[model samples]
Target: MTATMMTPAQLARFEARLLAERADAEERLAEFDGVMTEVRIARTDATADDEHDPEGPTMTQEWSQRSAVLADVRAELADVDRAIARIANGSYGVCTNCGKRITVARLDARPTAELCIDCARQAR
Candidate 1:
């Protein structure tokens, strides 16, 4: 049987989802950037008195958290970008594993997925 194709409306909905996610990631990344900038400036100023810097440990902890969060946000952004590209290339819903059409349910659940459920299960 021929694979079910995505309708224009469905594709629009998916696009909106990807774009919304991308915006959210961007927001988080910007927040992370702000935190990182403050941390960097605080750490590098060299004038922060060593006598009893109350912010030292706090800054260090925040830096570590920001780094980890940045990593996660970047990964999610990459996935969203890939999904947008797939949509543009007319390969959005096709499973990379078996060349089957991925169900709308799966795509809605994971817009960045490249593999179908069966293939993903086998790979796991």
Candidate 2:
């Protein structure tokens, strides 16, 4: 693995931040899973026209939103895991797409980022 440009303090901070975010993401994923399961069960056992209910979002709509959130959280957790692995291998501050040092500000804002600003802009 390539040497990281980040100082030990910076690396430690980023690692801490990523770990915290990963924990939050995992919690959210679990919460979403529980809510999704509940909605599924409720919809399955419903005798009324839940699909056309006017009181609130239908079970299908709630499920869709929860599933989307769960997917995003899962992806974020994966990114955090990858970032932690990079940190362990001494490549945490290197941009995966461009082989350049990722800016400190960018890293501070998103500790799990793998691409530099240019690469990320291009990716979008």
Candidate 3:
């Protein structure tokens, strides 16, 4: 394989890792959905009064925290999906910013990465 291209074995490994990440994110999102549903039902109770109860976090706070977690998981799933698409288009191991081959070590650590270490650090 050329320097810019990943070997077939490396491609397969990265693809599998990305797919697993996607699955985990999807599962977490589903769990969050179920918990959010329960929270919504609890909020509808006429005498619950969680806001003034002072036992723990209020229902609104729980809902907001869960929503933020759900959003992060959804973003992770999107990134994984994009990485998979890049694999299909023969650009999986190339950095989007510098157009260089992303190091195998970096990809092994973060299969959904879109930038090389240098470009990524520069962005930060």
Candidate 4:
């Protein structure tokens, strides 16, 4: 049998999911930005006295955590953007690596996924 294509309803549903995911990622990114800003401010405000205080978390440590979280949020936002583009280009539910139809269940679970389950697992 020929690989089934995504129906209009499926496309619409995935579109909605991608859009919602994008919004959530954007919000998280903004939140992280605010937090990173705070961390930078605190880091800059640190004085010679704070250097000797071992009880408080070091600004370097806080900055590291904030940077890591921000990177993850940005990556998620990029994935959402790519997925939306794929939707527009008529290839949203197609596996990029295997060129096969991704199952509806997987698409429903991760509209931003770029590969089939097998490829994804292998990638990991």
Of 2 and 4, which scores higher on lDDT? 2
Please report, as a residue range, the 10-residue window in candidate 1 with the lowest summed lDDT: 44-53
Write the residue-wise lDDT of candidate 3 on 1-124 in tens digits.
3245778998999888888888899999899989988887777662365446553457678778888998999999999999999999898889998789899999988888999999999999
Each prediction's total of clashing residue pairs, residues at least 3 apart in sequence or on different chains, is 0, 0, 0, 0
lDDT tens per residue, model 1, 42-73? 88663465746777777788878889989999
User: Considering summed lDDT, which 10 consecutive residues are worst modelled in model 4?
Assistant: 47-56
Which candidate number would show the highest lDDT if scored against the true structure? 1
Reference-based TM-score of each model: 0.83, 0.86, 0.86, 0.86
Q: lDDT at 83 for candidate 3?
A: 97
Give the alpha carbon lDDT tens digit for every residue of 22-42 in model 2.
888888888887888888778
Query: Among all windows of ten consecutive residues in candidate 3, which has the lowest summed lDDT?
Result: 46-55
Report the lDDT of model 4 for residue 41: 69
| Residue-pair clash count for candidate 1 | 0
- CA shift at 85, candidate 4, in angstroms? 0.4
Clashing pairs in 3: none
Clashing pairs in 1: none
lDDT of 2 at 56: 44
Q: What is candidate 1's local distance difference test score?
A: 0.86
